[model samples]
Target: MIRILAFVLTLGMLAACSAPPSSTGDEVQRLASEIRSLGPDIDPVEAERAARIAYSYSAQLAQEYEITDPPLVHNAKVNKGLRPRGLCWHWAEDIERRLDQEGFETLEMHRAIANADNPFRIDHSTAIISRKGETMRDGIVLDPWRYGGVLYWSPLTEDTKYEWVPRDAVLEKRRLDQHGALLPYVSG
Candidate 1:
Protein backbone atom coordinates (compact mmCIF):
# COMPACT_ATOMS: atom_id res chain seq x y z
CA MET A 1 0.00 0.00 0.00
CA ILE A 2 2.78 2.42 0.89
CA ARG A 3 4.54 1.68 -2.39
CA ILE A 4 1.35 2.30 -4.33
CA LEU A 5 0.76 5.57 -2.55
CA ALA A 6 4.29 6.72 -3.23
CA PHE A 7 3.98 5.84 -6.89
CA VAL A 8 0.71 7.69 -7.18
CA LEU A 9 2.16 10.81 -5.60
CA THR A 10 5.16 10.72 -7.86
CA LEU A 11 2.94 10.39 -10.90
CA GLY A 12 0.82 13.30 -9.75
CA MET A 13 3.84 15.51 -9.34
CA LEU A 14 5.16 14.57 -12.74
CA ALA A 15 1.84 15.37 -14.33
CA ALA A 16 1.69 18.72 -12.60
CA CYS A 17 5.22 19.55 -13.74
CA SER A 18 4.85 18.42 -17.30
CA ALA A 19 5.91 20.70 -20.12
CA PRO A 20 3.41 23.42 -21.03
CA PRO A 21 0.81 22.64 -23.69
CA SER A 22 1.57 22.39 -27.40
CA SER A 23 -0.48 25.37 -28.48
CA THR A 24 2.22 27.91 -27.76
CA GLY A 25 1.42 30.03 -30.76
CA ASP A 26 -1.66 31.25 -28.92
CA GLU A 27 0.55 32.30 -26.06
CA VAL A 28 2.86 34.11 -28.44
CA GLN A 29 -0.02 36.09 -29.88
CA ARG A 30 -1.34 36.96 -26.44
CA LEU A 31 2.05 38.11 -25.25
CA ALA A 32 2.58 40.15 -28.37
CA SER A 33 -0.72 41.92 -27.83
CA GLU A 34 0.20 42.67 -24.26
CA ILE A 35 3.61 43.98 -25.30
CA ARG A 36 2.09 46.24 -27.89
CA SER A 37 -0.23 47.64 -25.23
CA LEU A 38 2.73 48.95 -23.27
CA GLY A 39 2.82 52.16 -25.24
CA PRO A 40 1.97 53.66 -28.55
CA ASP A 41 5.60 54.06 -29.51
CA ILE A 42 6.28 50.31 -29.25
CA ASP A 43 6.63 48.74 -32.67
CA PRO A 44 4.12 45.98 -33.37
CA VAL A 45 6.68 43.99 -35.32
CA GLU A 46 9.16 44.19 -32.46
CA ALA A 47 6.50 43.14 -29.98
CA GLU A 48 5.61 40.08 -32.05
CA ARG A 49 9.23 39.09 -32.47
CA ALA A 50 9.99 39.59 -28.81
CA ALA A 51 6.99 37.52 -27.76
CA ARG A 52 7.92 34.72 -30.14
CA ILE A 53 11.49 34.64 -28.90
CA ALA A 54 10.50 34.73 -25.26
CA TYR A 55 8.33 31.63 -25.51
CA SER A 56 10.55 29.67 -27.86
CA TYR A 57 13.72 30.45 -25.94
CA SER A 58 12.12 29.44 -22.70
CA ALA A 59 11.17 26.08 -24.21
CA GLN A 60 14.70 25.72 -25.51
CA LEU A 61 16.17 26.46 -22.11
CA ALA A 62 13.86 23.95 -20.48
CA GLN A 63 15.34 21.23 -22.65
CA GLU A 64 18.88 22.48 -22.16
CA TYR A 65 18.45 22.68 -18.39
CA GLU A 66 17.08 19.13 -18.30
CA ILE A 67 14.18 20.38 -16.25
CA THR A 68 12.20 17.33 -15.27
CA ASP A 69 11.48 18.50 -11.74
CA PRO A 70 9.48 21.28 -10.25
CA PRO A 71 11.17 24.66 -9.88
CA LEU A 72 12.24 24.32 -6.27
CA VAL A 73 13.35 20.77 -6.85
CA HIS A 74 15.44 21.84 -9.82
CA ASN A 75 16.83 24.70 -7.77
CA ALA A 76 17.93 22.27 -5.10
CA LYS A 77 19.53 20.08 -7.75
CA VAL A 78 21.37 23.10 -9.10
CA ASN A 79 22.62 24.03 -5.65
CA LYS A 80 23.75 20.45 -5.02
CA GLY A 81 25.56 20.39 -8.38
CA LEU A 82 23.28 17.71 -9.66
CA ARG A 83 21.99 19.93 -12.46
CA PRO A 84 23.87 22.45 -14.55
CA ARG A 85 21.28 25.22 -14.37
CA GLY A 86 17.55 25.86 -13.83
CA LEU A 87 17.41 28.55 -11.19
CA CYS A 88 15.30 31.64 -11.45
CA TRP A 89 18.33 33.81 -11.95
CA HIS A 90 19.59 31.53 -14.69
CA TRP A 91 16.34 31.91 -16.61
CA ALA A 92 16.36 35.65 -16.12
CA GLU A 93 19.96 35.98 -17.21
CA ASP A 94 19.67 33.76 -20.24
CA ILE A 95 16.44 35.33 -21.43
CA GLU A 96 17.81 38.81 -20.95
CA ARG A 97 20.95 37.89 -22.86
CA ARG A 98 18.99 36.45 -25.76
CA LEU A 99 16.54 39.34 -25.88
CA ASP A 100 19.37 41.83 -25.80
CA GLN A 101 20.68 40.37 -29.02
CA GLU A 102 17.64 41.66 -30.88
CA GLY A 103 18.69 45.27 -30.33
CA PHE A 104 15.06 46.20 -30.04
CA GLU A 105 14.57 49.74 -31.19
CA THR A 106 11.43 50.57 -29.22
CA LEU A 107 11.63 48.10 -26.39
CA GLU A 108 14.04 47.53 -23.50
CA MET A 109 14.73 44.72 -21.10
CA HIS A 110 15.24 44.92 -17.37
CA ARG A 111 16.01 42.50 -14.55
CA ALA A 112 14.17 42.47 -11.26
CA ILE A 113 14.46 40.70 -7.91
CA ALA A 114 11.49 39.92 -5.71
CA ASN A 115 11.48 39.06 -2.01
CA ALA A 116 14.94 40.54 -1.68
CA ASP A 117 13.88 42.47 1.37
CA ASN A 118 12.12 39.54 2.96
CA PRO A 119 14.45 37.38 4.98
CA PHE A 120 11.93 34.59 5.28
CA ARG A 121 11.54 33.98 1.54
CA ILE A 122 14.00 33.18 -1.19
CA ASP A 123 14.65 35.90 -3.74
CA HIS A 124 13.14 35.45 -7.20
CA SER A 125 14.70 36.91 -10.31
CA THR A 126 12.93 37.57 -13.62
CA ALA A 127 13.21 39.49 -16.84
CA ILE A 128 10.95 42.39 -17.66
CA ILE A 129 10.26 44.15 -20.95
CA SER A 130 9.09 47.71 -21.29
CA ARG A 131 9.09 50.63 -23.64
CA LYS A 132 12.59 51.97 -24.17
CA GLY A 133 12.10 55.05 -22.03
CA GLU A 134 10.26 53.33 -19.19
CA THR A 135 11.42 51.49 -16.08
CA MET A 136 10.91 47.94 -14.95
CA ARG A 137 7.83 48.85 -12.94
CA ASP A 138 6.13 49.69 -16.18
CA GLY A 139 7.22 46.52 -17.93
CA ILE A 140 5.89 43.02 -18.35
CA VAL A 141 7.38 40.24 -16.27
CA LEU A 142 8.82 37.30 -18.23
CA ASP A 143 9.25 34.52 -15.72
CA PRO A 144 10.05 30.97 -16.81
CA TRP A 145 11.25 29.40 -13.59
CA ARG A 146 8.04 29.51 -11.61
CA TYR A 147 6.65 26.36 -13.20
CA GLY A 148 9.81 24.51 -14.08
CA GLY A 149 10.29 26.26 -17.45
CA VAL A 150 6.74 27.11 -18.47
CA LEU A 151 6.69 30.76 -19.39
CA TYR A 152 4.56 33.03 -17.18
CA TRP A 153 4.11 36.68 -17.98
CA SER A 154 2.02 39.57 -16.70
CA PRO A 155 2.09 43.29 -16.50
CA LEU A 156 4.28 44.30 -13.58
CA THR A 157 1.41 45.73 -11.66
CA GLU A 158 -0.69 42.64 -12.29
CA ASP A 159 1.72 40.12 -10.84
CA THR A 160 0.04 39.89 -7.48
CA LYS A 161 2.28 37.23 -6.03
CA TYR A 162 5.53 39.18 -6.18
CA GLU A 163 6.53 42.67 -5.28
CA TRP A 164 9.47 43.32 -7.55
CA VAL A 165 12.30 45.78 -7.22
CA PRO A 166 15.00 46.72 -9.67
CA ARG A 167 17.84 44.22 -9.40
CA ASP A 168 20.55 46.89 -9.16
CA ALA A 169 18.72 48.73 -6.43
CA VAL A 170 18.26 45.55 -4.46
CA LEU A 171 21.96 44.69 -4.78
CA GLU A 172 22.99 48.20 -3.82
CA LYS A 173 20.78 48.13 -0.77
CA ARG A 174 22.22 44.80 0.27
CA ARG A 175 25.69 46.26 -0.09
CA LEU A 176 24.71 49.19 2.09
CA ASP A 177 23.07 46.88 4.60
CA GLN A 178 26.27 44.89 4.87
CA HIS A 179 28.19 47.97 5.90
CA GLY A 180 26.59 48.00 9.37
CA ALA A 181 23.72 50.13 8.04
CA LEU A 182 20.34 48.53 8.34
CA LEU A 183 17.70 49.45 5.85
CA PRO A 184 14.01 48.93 6.42
CA TYR A 185 12.20 46.61 4.06
CA VAL A 186 9.80 48.39 1.76
CA SER A 187 7.14 46.48 -0.08
CA GLY A 188 6.23 47.65 -3.54
Candidate 2:
Protein backbone atom coordinates (compact mmCIF):
# COMPACT_ATOMS: atom_id res chain seq x y z
CA MET A 1 0.00 0.00 0.00
CA ILE A 2 2.80 2.43 0.91
CA ARG A 3 4.63 1.73 -2.35
CA ILE A 4 1.50 2.33 -4.41
CA LEU A 5 0.73 5.57 -2.56
CA ALA A 6 4.24 6.88 -3.11
CA PHE A 7 4.11 6.05 -6.81
CA VAL A 8 0.79 7.81 -7.21
CA LEU A 9 2.05 10.86 -5.35
CA THR A 10 5.16 11.04 -7.52
CA LEU A 11 3.11 10.76 -10.65
CA GLY A 12 0.80 13.50 -9.52
CA MET A 13 3.71 15.81 -8.84
CA LEU A 14 5.23 15.13 -12.23
CA ALA A 15 1.97 15.87 -13.98
CA ALA A 16 1.56 19.13 -12.11
CA CYS A 17 5.08 20.20 -12.92
CA SER A 18 4.66 19.47 -16.61
CA ALA A 19 1.34 21.23 -16.99
CA PRO A 20 1.32 23.99 -19.59
CA PRO A 21 1.73 27.57 -18.48
CA SER A 22 -0.78 30.34 -19.33
CA SER A 23 -2.58 30.06 -22.67
CA THR A 24 -1.59 33.60 -23.67
CA GLY A 25 0.38 32.28 -26.62
CA ASP A 26 -2.60 30.49 -28.09
CA GLU A 27 -4.86 33.45 -27.44
CA VAL A 28 -2.49 35.79 -29.23
CA GLN A 29 -2.20 33.50 -32.22
CA ARG A 30 -5.92 33.05 -32.53
CA LEU A 31 -6.47 36.79 -32.59
CA ALA A 32 -3.79 37.25 -35.22
CA SER A 33 -5.21 34.59 -37.51
CA GLU A 34 -8.66 36.12 -37.28
CA ILE A 35 -7.30 39.48 -38.33
CA ARG A 36 -5.36 37.95 -41.22
CA SER A 37 -8.50 36.28 -42.47
CA LEU A 38 -10.25 39.61 -42.80
CA GLY A 39 -11.14 41.00 -46.23
CA PRO A 40 -8.37 42.63 -48.28
CA ASP A 41 -10.39 45.86 -48.52
CA ILE A 42 -10.12 46.22 -44.76
CA ASP A 43 -7.69 49.05 -44.21
CA PRO A 44 -4.65 47.84 -42.36
CA VAL A 45 -3.39 51.40 -42.55
CA GLU A 46 -5.46 53.00 -39.82
CA ALA A 47 -3.85 52.93 -36.37
CA GLU A 48 -6.86 51.34 -34.80
CA ARG A 49 -7.30 48.86 -37.62
CA ALA A 50 -3.60 48.17 -37.78
CA ALA A 51 -3.43 47.64 -34.06
CA ARG A 52 -6.18 45.10 -34.25
CA ILE A 53 -4.53 43.31 -37.15
CA ALA A 54 -1.09 43.29 -35.56
CA TYR A 55 -2.42 42.21 -32.22
CA SER A 56 -4.32 39.31 -33.71
CA TYR A 57 -1.40 38.20 -35.87
CA SER A 58 0.98 38.42 -32.94
CA ALA A 59 -1.37 36.49 -30.71
CA GLN A 60 -1.79 33.74 -33.30
CA LEU A 61 1.95 33.38 -33.73
CA ALA A 62 2.34 33.10 -30.00
CA GLN A 63 -0.36 30.46 -29.78
CA GLU A 64 0.89 28.40 -32.69
CA TYR A 65 4.47 28.51 -31.39
CA GLU A 66 3.63 27.74 -27.74
CA ILE A 67 5.71 30.58 -26.35
CA THR A 68 4.38 31.40 -22.88
CA ASP A 69 7.19 33.06 -21.03
CA PRO A 70 8.55 36.52 -21.60
CA PRO A 71 11.24 36.69 -24.26
CA LEU A 72 14.73 35.88 -22.94
CA VAL A 73 18.24 35.66 -24.29
CA HIS A 74 18.61 31.97 -23.49
CA ASN A 75 15.31 31.20 -25.23
CA ALA A 76 16.54 32.99 -28.31
CA LYS A 77 19.86 31.13 -28.21
CA VAL A 78 18.30 27.70 -27.96
CA ASN A 79 15.52 28.31 -30.49
CA LYS A 80 17.75 30.06 -33.01
CA GLY A 81 20.37 27.34 -33.05
CA LEU A 82 17.95 24.43 -33.06
CA ARG A 83 15.05 25.82 -35.13
CA PRO A 84 14.84 26.03 -38.90
CA ARG A 85 16.52 28.97 -40.68
CA GLY A 86 18.04 30.02 -37.36
CA LEU A 87 16.91 33.54 -38.13
CA CYS A 88 14.98 34.75 -35.12
CA TRP A 89 15.83 38.40 -35.61
CA HIS A 90 14.74 38.26 -39.21
CA TRP A 91 11.28 37.11 -38.21
CA ALA A 92 10.96 39.76 -35.52
CA GLU A 93 12.08 42.53 -37.85
CA ASP A 94 9.73 41.42 -40.56
CA ILE A 95 6.75 41.36 -38.24
CA GLU A 96 7.51 44.80 -36.87
CA ARG A 97 7.90 46.22 -40.35
CA ARG A 98 4.74 44.58 -41.58
CA LEU A 99 2.73 45.97 -38.69
CA ASP A 100 4.17 49.40 -39.34
CA GLN A 101 3.41 49.30 -43.03
CA GLU A 102 -0.13 48.43 -42.13
CA GLY A 103 -0.33 51.77 -40.23
CA PHE A 104 0.54 50.73 -36.69
CA GLU A 105 3.29 52.65 -34.93
CA THR A 106 6.06 50.26 -33.90
CA LEU A 107 8.81 50.61 -31.38
CA GLU A 108 11.86 48.37 -31.14
CA MET A 109 12.36 47.52 -27.50
CA HIS A 110 15.58 46.27 -25.94
CA ARG A 111 15.98 44.76 -22.51
CA ALA A 112 18.54 46.90 -20.79
CA ILE A 113 20.94 45.21 -18.39
CA ALA A 114 19.75 45.96 -14.86
CA ASN A 115 23.06 45.54 -13.08
CA ALA A 116 26.32 47.35 -13.72
CA ASP A 117 28.76 44.62 -12.64
CA ASN A 118 27.47 41.47 -14.29
CA PRO A 119 29.52 40.13 -17.16
CA PHE A 120 26.87 38.60 -19.39
CA ARG A 121 25.05 40.88 -21.81
CA ILE A 122 22.07 40.45 -24.11
CA ASP A 123 19.03 42.23 -25.55
CA HIS A 124 15.71 41.26 -27.16
CA SER A 125 13.45 43.20 -29.53
CA THR A 126 9.67 43.58 -29.76
CA ALA A 127 6.90 45.65 -31.32
CA ILE A 128 4.55 48.05 -29.51
CA ILE A 129 1.27 49.15 -31.06
CA SER A 130 -0.78 52.27 -30.33
CA ARG A 131 -4.45 52.36 -31.21
CA LYS A 132 -6.83 55.23 -30.60
CA GLY A 133 -9.63 54.92 -28.02
CA GLU A 134 -8.45 51.54 -26.84
CA THR A 135 -7.41 51.70 -23.22
CA MET A 136 -5.58 48.36 -23.41
CA ARG A 137 -2.03 48.60 -24.70
CA ASP A 138 -0.23 45.63 -26.27
CA GLY A 139 3.44 44.86 -26.71
CA ILE A 140 5.17 41.79 -28.11
CA VAL A 141 8.59 40.47 -27.19
CA LEU A 142 10.00 38.65 -30.20
CA ASP A 143 12.52 35.87 -29.75
CA PRO A 144 12.89 32.39 -31.13
CA TRP A 145 10.85 33.71 -34.04
CA ARG A 146 7.97 33.97 -31.57
CA TYR A 147 6.21 36.90 -29.95
CA GLY A 148 5.34 36.94 -26.23
CA GLY A 149 2.61 39.49 -25.75
CA VAL A 150 3.12 41.80 -22.79
CA LEU A 151 -0.50 42.90 -22.85
CA TYR A 152 -1.10 46.12 -21.00
CA TRP A 153 -1.93 49.78 -21.55
CA SER A 154 -0.26 52.20 -23.92
CA PRO A 155 2.84 54.36 -23.15
CA LEU A 156 4.36 51.83 -20.82
CA THR A 157 6.65 54.18 -18.96
CA GLU A 158 7.25 52.14 -15.83
CA ASP A 159 7.27 48.49 -16.96
CA THR A 160 9.56 48.84 -19.94
CA LYS A 161 12.58 47.34 -18.20
CA TYR A 162 12.56 43.55 -17.94
CA GLU A 163 13.60 41.99 -14.63
CA TRP A 164 14.55 38.53 -15.91
CA VAL A 165 18.23 39.11 -16.69
CA PRO A 166 20.78 39.06 -13.91
CA ARG A 167 21.73 42.62 -13.08
CA ASP A 168 25.14 44.06 -12.12
CA ALA A 169 26.77 42.20 -14.98
CA VAL A 170 29.01 44.35 -17.11
CA LEU A 171 28.30 44.14 -20.81
CA GLU A 172 31.01 41.60 -21.59
CA LYS A 173 30.24 41.23 -25.26
CA ARG A 174 27.73 41.86 -27.99
CA ARG A 175 26.64 38.66 -29.80
CA LEU A 176 24.55 40.00 -32.67
CA ASP A 177 27.45 39.96 -35.14
CA GLN A 178 28.23 36.29 -34.64
CA HIS A 179 26.96 33.96 -37.35
CA GLY A 180 23.82 32.13 -36.27
CA ALA A 181 23.92 33.77 -32.84
CA LEU A 182 20.45 34.48 -31.51
CA LEU A 183 20.93 36.86 -28.61
CA PRO A 184 22.39 40.34 -28.74
CA TYR A 185 25.02 39.47 -26.17
CA VAL A 186 27.00 36.43 -24.99
CA SER A 187 28.29 36.70 -21.46
CA GLY A 188 31.80 35.76 -20.41
Candidate 3:
Protein backbone atom coordinates (compact mmCIF):
# COMPACT_ATOMS: atom_id res chain seq x y z
CA MET A 1 0.00 0.00 0.00
CA ILE A 2 2.80 2.38 0.83
CA ARG A 3 4.54 1.53 -2.43
CA ILE A 4 1.41 2.28 -4.37
CA LEU A 5 0.90 5.55 -2.59
CA ALA A 6 4.52 6.54 -3.17
CA PHE A 7 4.16 5.65 -6.84
CA VAL A 8 1.04 7.76 -7.20
CA LEU A 9 2.65 10.65 -5.38
CA THR A 10 5.81 10.45 -7.45
CA LEU A 11 3.78 10.55 -10.64
CA GLY A 12 1.73 13.47 -9.42
CA MET A 13 4.89 15.26 -8.31
CA LEU A 14 6.64 14.74 -11.62
CA ALA A 15 3.60 15.84 -13.57
CA ALA A 16 3.19 18.97 -11.50
CA CYS A 17 6.88 19.77 -11.80
CA SER A 18 6.94 19.26 -15.54
CA ALA A 19 3.88 21.34 -16.33
CA PRO A 20 4.76 24.87 -17.35
CA PRO A 21 4.17 27.53 -14.74
CA SER A 22 0.72 29.11 -15.02
CA SER A 23 -1.47 31.69 -13.37
CA THR A 24 -4.77 30.44 -14.76
CA GLY A 25 -7.27 29.91 -11.98
CA ASP A 26 -8.00 26.43 -13.26
CA GLU A 27 -4.38 25.38 -13.22
CA VAL A 28 -3.86 27.02 -9.87
CA GLN A 29 -6.97 25.36 -8.49
CA ARG A 30 -5.76 21.95 -9.68
CA LEU A 31 -2.28 22.28 -8.23
CA ALA A 32 -3.55 23.93 -5.08
CA SER A 33 -6.02 21.12 -4.64
CA GLU A 34 -3.23 18.55 -4.82
CA ILE A 35 -1.12 20.37 -2.23
CA ARG A 36 -4.09 20.82 0.02
CA SER A 37 -4.67 17.08 -0.38
CA LEU A 38 -1.74 16.75 2.02
CA GLY A 39 -3.22 19.43 4.27
CA PRO A 40 -2.14 23.03 3.55
CA ASP A 41 -4.06 26.22 2.80
CA ILE A 42 -2.03 27.47 -0.16
CA ASP A 43 -3.07 29.38 -3.27
CA PRO A 44 -3.06 26.85 -6.12
CA VAL A 45 -1.34 29.15 -8.59
CA GLU A 46 1.36 29.89 -6.07
CA ALA A 47 1.65 26.24 -5.20
CA GLU A 48 2.11 25.31 -8.87
CA ARG A 49 4.85 27.84 -9.31
CA ALA A 50 6.53 26.79 -6.09
CA ALA A 51 6.65 23.15 -7.11
CA ARG A 52 7.97 24.00 -10.57
CA ILE A 53 10.69 26.15 -9.11
CA ALA A 54 11.60 23.55 -6.53
CA TYR A 55 11.94 20.78 -9.11
CA SER A 56 13.87 22.93 -11.53
CA TYR A 57 16.27 24.07 -8.83
CA SER A 58 16.65 20.58 -7.44
CA ALA A 59 17.81 19.44 -10.85
CA GLN A 60 20.21 22.30 -11.05
CA LEU A 61 21.61 21.59 -7.59
CA ALA A 62 21.82 17.87 -8.34
CA GLN A 63 24.05 18.65 -11.29
CA GLU A 64 26.01 21.46 -9.71
CA TYR A 65 26.67 19.50 -6.53
CA GLU A 66 27.45 16.27 -8.38
CA ILE A 67 24.72 14.38 -6.62
CA THR A 68 24.71 10.62 -6.96
CA ASP A 69 22.43 7.74 -6.05
CA PRO A 70 22.15 7.06 -2.31
CA PRO A 71 22.55 10.70 -1.26
CA LEU A 72 25.71 11.60 0.61
CA VAL A 73 25.37 12.25 4.29
CA HIS A 74 26.11 15.81 5.35
CA ASN A 75 29.36 16.22 7.31
CA ALA A 76 30.35 12.63 6.60
CA LYS A 77 33.92 12.35 5.42
CA VAL A 78 32.66 11.04 2.09
CA ASN A 79 30.45 14.12 1.66
CA LYS A 80 33.00 16.80 2.44
CA GLY A 81 34.12 19.37 -0.16
CA LEU A 82 32.55 20.40 -3.48
CA ARG A 83 32.74 16.97 -5.10
CA PRO A 84 29.50 15.20 -4.01
CA ARG A 85 26.88 17.66 -2.89
CA GLY A 86 24.17 15.11 -2.24
CA LEU A 87 23.32 16.12 1.31
CA CYS A 88 19.59 16.03 1.96
CA TRP A 89 19.83 19.44 3.59
CA HIS A 90 21.15 20.83 0.32
CA TRP A 91 17.98 19.68 -1.36
CA ALA A 92 15.97 21.27 1.43
CA GLU A 93 17.75 24.59 1.04
CA ASP A 94 17.29 24.58 -2.73
CA ILE A 95 13.55 24.14 -2.39
CA GLU A 96 13.37 26.59 0.47
CA ARG A 97 15.06 29.32 -1.56
CA ARG A 98 12.82 28.75 -4.57
CA LEU A 99 9.61 28.84 -2.55
CA ASP A 100 10.87 31.80 -0.54
CA GLN A 101 10.94 33.77 -3.77
CA GLU A 102 7.35 32.80 -4.63
CA GLY A 103 6.32 34.30 -1.25
CA PHE A 104 2.79 33.00 -0.84
CA GLU A 105 0.07 35.35 0.26
CA THR A 106 -1.73 32.77 2.36
CA LEU A 107 1.17 30.55 3.32
CA GLU A 108 4.58 30.95 4.90
CA MET A 109 7.53 28.76 3.99
CA HIS A 110 9.36 27.25 6.96
CA ARG A 111 12.71 25.61 7.26
CA ALA A 112 11.69 22.79 9.59
CA ILE A 113 14.07 20.99 11.90
CA ALA A 114 12.92 17.39 12.11
CA ASN A 115 13.63 14.91 14.89
CA ALA A 116 15.08 17.65 17.05
CA ASP A 117 14.60 15.40 20.05
CA ASN A 118 16.66 12.53 18.80
CA PRO A 119 18.80 10.68 21.34
CA PHE A 120 21.86 11.41 19.24
CA ARG A 121 20.75 15.02 18.93
CA ILE A 122 20.65 14.72 15.16
CA ASP A 123 17.99 16.57 13.25
CA HIS A 124 16.83 16.20 9.66
CA SER A 125 15.89 19.44 8.00
CA THR A 126 13.32 20.09 5.28
CA ALA A 127 11.11 22.78 3.75
CA ILE A 128 7.59 23.29 5.06
CA ILE A 129 4.62 25.41 3.96
CA SER A 130 1.67 26.21 6.10
CA ARG A 131 -0.92 28.94 6.58
CA LYS A 132 0.75 32.20 7.52
CA GLY A 133 1.84 32.27 11.14
CA GLU A 134 0.79 28.67 11.74
CA THR A 135 2.98 26.50 13.90
CA MET A 136 5.66 24.27 12.38
CA ARG A 137 3.68 21.41 13.82
CA ASP A 138 0.93 22.48 11.43
CA GLY A 139 3.07 22.67 8.30
CA ILE A 140 3.54 20.22 5.42
CA VAL A 141 7.03 18.71 5.18
CA LEU A 142 8.48 19.04 1.68
CA ASP A 143 11.60 16.84 1.76
CA PRO A 144 13.17 16.29 -1.64
CA TRP A 145 16.47 14.98 -0.33
CA ARG A 146 15.20 11.95 1.56
CA TYR A 147 14.67 9.87 -1.57
CA GLY A 148 17.76 11.00 -3.44
CA GLY A 149 16.04 13.98 -5.10
CA VAL A 150 12.47 12.62 -5.18
CA LEU A 151 10.22 15.06 -3.33
CA TYR A 152 8.53 13.49 -0.30
CA TRP A 153 5.90 15.54 1.48
CA SER A 154 3.14 15.02 4.01
CA PRO A 155 1.63 16.75 6.99
CA LEU A 156 4.45 17.25 9.53
CA THR A 157 2.51 15.64 12.34
CA GLU A 158 1.77 12.63 10.14
CA ASP A 159 5.19 12.31 8.56
CA THR A 160 6.29 8.68 8.97
CA LYS A 161 10.03 8.99 8.61
CA TYR A 162 10.70 11.57 11.31
CA GLU A 163 9.05 13.57 14.03
CA TRP A 164 9.06 17.22 12.85
CA VAL A 165 8.39 18.88 16.16
CA PRO A 166 8.99 22.63 16.29
CA ARG A 167 12.27 22.53 18.22
CA ASP A 168 14.54 20.25 20.18
CA ALA A 169 12.02 20.86 22.88
CA VAL A 170 8.38 21.21 21.86
CA LEU A 171 8.21 24.48 23.79
CA GLU A 172 11.27 26.08 22.19
CA LYS A 173 9.56 27.19 18.98
CA ARG A 174 12.45 28.46 16.88
CA ARG A 175 12.61 29.29 13.17
CA LEU A 176 15.42 28.53 10.72
CA ASP A 177 17.30 31.48 9.27
CA GLN A 178 16.29 32.78 5.84
CA HIS A 179 19.75 31.71 4.71
CA GLY A 180 18.30 28.28 5.55
CA ALA A 181 21.54 26.51 6.30
CA LEU A 182 21.74 24.61 9.54
CA LEU A 183 25.10 24.62 11.27
CA PRO A 184 24.79 20.86 11.71
CA TYR A 185 22.35 17.93 11.78
CA VAL A 186 22.06 17.57 8.00
CA SER A 187 21.91 13.79 8.09
CA GLY A 188 19.18 11.99 6.19
Leading candidate by TM-score:
1
Q: How would you encode candidate 2's per-residue C-alpha lDDT over 23-90 as one tens digit per residue?
A: 55454444343333333432343434554645565556555445544344325444666422223344
Alpha-carbon TM-score of each model against the true structure? 0.84, 0.37, 0.61
Deviation in Å, model 3, residue 142 alpha carbon: 0.8
Global lDDT scores for all candidate models: 0.91, 0.40, 0.61
Q: Which candidate leads the pack in lDDT?
A: 1
lDDT of 3 at 147: 57
Q: Could you give candidate 1's per-residue lDDT for residues 27-65 as a string of tens digits? A: 999999999999999999999999999999999999999
**Colliding pairs, model 1:** none
Clashes of 1: 0
Query: Per TM-score, what order, best first?
Result: 1, 3, 2
Q: On a 0 to 100 scale, what is the lDDT of residue 167 in model 3?
A: 33
Candidate 3 TM-score, C-alpha based: 0.61
- Name the lDDT value of residue 179 in candidate 2: 42
Quote the RMSD, in angstroms, for model 1.
6.5
Better of 2 and 3 by lDDT: 3
